[model samples]
Each structure stands twice: as structure tokens, then as C-alpha cells.
Target: MDRPHWSVPLALVWVSSFFLHFAWEMWQVVFYEGMATASHAAAIWICTKATFGDANIALAAYLAAALSVCSIDWVRTPTGTPLFFYLAAGLLITVLFEYLATEVLGRWEYNEQMPTLPLLGTGLLPLAQWIVVPLVSLYATRLMYFGFLPMREYAANKPA
Candidate 1:
């Protein structure tokens, strides 16, 4: 079946998100590089260390929350949400889910290298992923799947 044209706003959201994935990868590179510079071998260890224990658990919890929200298609407008607001909401949702799941789900626990006032204070890495990438990714995926936009159009129309 053929797909109809996407509303321009949805196209912008989709295109922006496509670029944002690259942006996140760049950030991750910076993070990993920073870790490496501290000491190459030690950086690898530290990076792995970052994912250790309950931190992994908390990270998983964050992904679940973000996935749940993303799955909803509840984003009200397919075009966009206020930029800062959407990101902030995504952050809140990720943090809340990680918090509640650790407190309630018991499916996992946080890998806190050192426990702090906040259960997994260092778990910010995972939370950031959920907020910045996955939420927009979800939006982009829906835009394509629902025929608000389609990959074939994208492929053909991509600038030469």
C-alpha cells in the first residue's frame, strides 16, 4: 500500500530525531573518551564499573519506563511537544519508574557502587538515555509506522 505525505511538522520531528541519534552517539563517545583518558585500562574498568551492580538494575528499570511511555502513542500531538518540556517529562518518567521499580518491582535492584541519599544517584546515565534518545526515537518510530511518514519516501527524497 502507498503512504500519504506526512504533515510537515511530523516530518521535522522525524528528521530531527534521526539526527539526534547521531548526537547521542557523539555524547557517548565523549563520555567513553573521558573515561579512557583517566587511564586506558582503568577507563575500561571504570566504564564497566559504571554499569555494575544495582546500576544495571536501575538502568533496566529506566528503559522499561521509557519504553512504556513510548509505546503509549499518548504524546497528544504527533508534531511536537515543547522541546524542554518533553525532555523534562521524559526525565521525570524515567526517574520515577526506576525509583518505583526498585522500591516495588523487586525484579531488579540498583547497582550502587556507593549508596547515597538517592538510591542510585549515579544511575543518571541510564536515565539520560531514556529521556533524550528513546522518547524521540519512539516518536519517530510511530511517525513512520502510522504512515504519518514512511521510510520509502524518506529514502527517495533524501537529498542527493
Candidate 2:
């Protein structure tokens, strides 16, 4: 059967991104006292910020995967482009963006409960989620729809 339209995948990615980031933040709240004692408004504000930020990250990941996959034929898979590409690009983008935001820009801070990683100087949970969430999103999207239907159709229609 044919897969759903491009919007289907996009919606899926967007919703998944929101939920994943919220959950990540909650994990921090529980373990790292990350706003755990904050008032209801503070918690909502924090989650809202994370959701917005992650939405952008998700969009960047999709863009990077689509652009990279278009140039490299080997990366294409039956259902879509390779999930690994998305995962790798997502991780790289998220890590760099988050590292700058937290460490360099001083936009955010991690608590003592956060697990640190060498070189990254960031929490293990955040870095790991970039890998986990993107992989899950890509895999789920592929299962639900074909890989980038518009691009696939264009390539099929282009001159041999």
C-alpha cells in the first residue's frame, strides 16, 4: 500500500519531538531537581521552552537528513533514507546546539544530578536522547509512510 503524504511524516516528527523533550525534561526534574520544586507556572514555562526548542531541532534533523540523503544514493533505504543518517545528524545538531546554549551562551544550566560526559561537558540524558528520539522518530515514520514521498516521486520522474 502507498504511504501517507509528506504532512503525515512531518506531523509525526513534530509531535514526537514535543513529547520526547517534555519527557526528557521531566526525567531531569525527577533526578536532578530540575525545577522539581518550582511552582506550576515555572514548570509549564520550562516545558514550553523545551518544546519549542526541540521543535526546531526536529525540523533541522529532517532538513539535514533530506539534504544529505538526496546527495548520497547509498544512504537510501526501501522505506526511506537510512535511519542512521537521521540519528547521526540529529545527534550532531542537537549536541552542538545544546552545548552552545547551555555551556557557551549560558542560556541554561545543569544540576549536580545530571550525569556528565567527557569532552561534551553536558548531561548524559540530553546527549543520549538526541540519539534515541531521532532514531525512534525516523523508524516510526518509515513504518507509517514511505521515505520523503515528494523527493522519491521526483527522483522517479526525472530523466534516466
Candidate 3:
């Protein structure tokens, strides 16, 4: 089989990551921040888009890490990374983004409403949000593209 091109898969992953992260961030903000007021539609939309930007930053970080690894011996292609390594790269990248965005850049703030880890001083929801949503998105994308899940196979060979 020919090696798969990196562009399409990377685009798909980028979009999937954006939406997945946006949805999870929206959920957390609504439930925890009490920002679900009917009048807050515009605010909700803005917040959702901000999270989308965050997701895009994460995708860039992941792709950078993947390309860096691809330059190494074992992983030769950008898309050839193992899932575990991909996830680990994303986690580390996102943690750094979170720290810089919250602590350094003052882009956003987390209140007492968010569950904080002792040493990290960061919310658990945001940290876990990257993990759960991206993994599910990747799994679903794999199932769709690779036919990994069990399903009825239609036979083209058998004809009446």
C-alpha cells in the first residue's frame, strides 16, 4: 500500500480536535461557571470560539512534536506516530499552553469553582478535557477510516 499523505489526515485531526475541545470547554464553563443564562448566548458563543483557538494551539503543538519525532529514527512519517506518543505529546503541550495562557499571558482565569490540583494550581477539568475528547475523536476517526469496529461486510463476489 502506498504511504498515506499527511495533509488530509492532519486536517481531519485538527478539525476533530477543535470541535471536541470546544464542546468539552463549553460544558465545563456552563456547569461550573454558571454562564448558562438565556441572555448569555453571545457570551457562550465567544467563549466557545476562544476554546477553539486553544484547541488550534494544541493541534499546532501536537503536529510540531509529531514532526520532531518523525525526524527521529523510528517514526519516519508525521502521521506514523503511535497513539500513546501522540496523546502524551498533546498532554504535555496542552499543559504548557494552559500554564502560559493562564499564568503568564493572563488570557483567562479559573475560579474556585474549578477543581484544582495541589501543586499544579490548575483545574482538573481543563487538563482532562484534552485527554478524553481527543482520544474519543481519534478512536472514532480510526473506526471510520480503517474499519476497525466489527460490522456486517457486504460481499461483492456473491451474485444471484
Please report, in order, the local distance difference test score of every candidate based on alpha carbons.
0.46, 0.67, 0.61
lDDT of 3 by residue, 5-119 (tens): 6664566666777777777776777534435553568667866776777667656655665665663211222244555566677677677766787778976667667776687
Which stretches in model 1 have alpha-carbon errors above 4 Å?
A: 1-81, 113-122, 134-160
How does model 2 fare in lDDT?
0.67
User: What is the clash count of model 1?
Assistant: 4
Clashing pairs in 2: none
lDDT of 1 at 14: 43
Among all windows of ten consecutive residues in candidate 1, which has the lowest summed lDDT? 71-80
Q: Write the per-residue lDDT of candidate 1 for residues 84-141, one digit (tens) a residue.
A: 4445555665566656655667533444332323655434554666465646655565
RMSD of 2: 6.6
Clashes of each: 4, 0, 0
What is the descending lDDT order?
2, 3, 1
Clashing pairs in 3: none
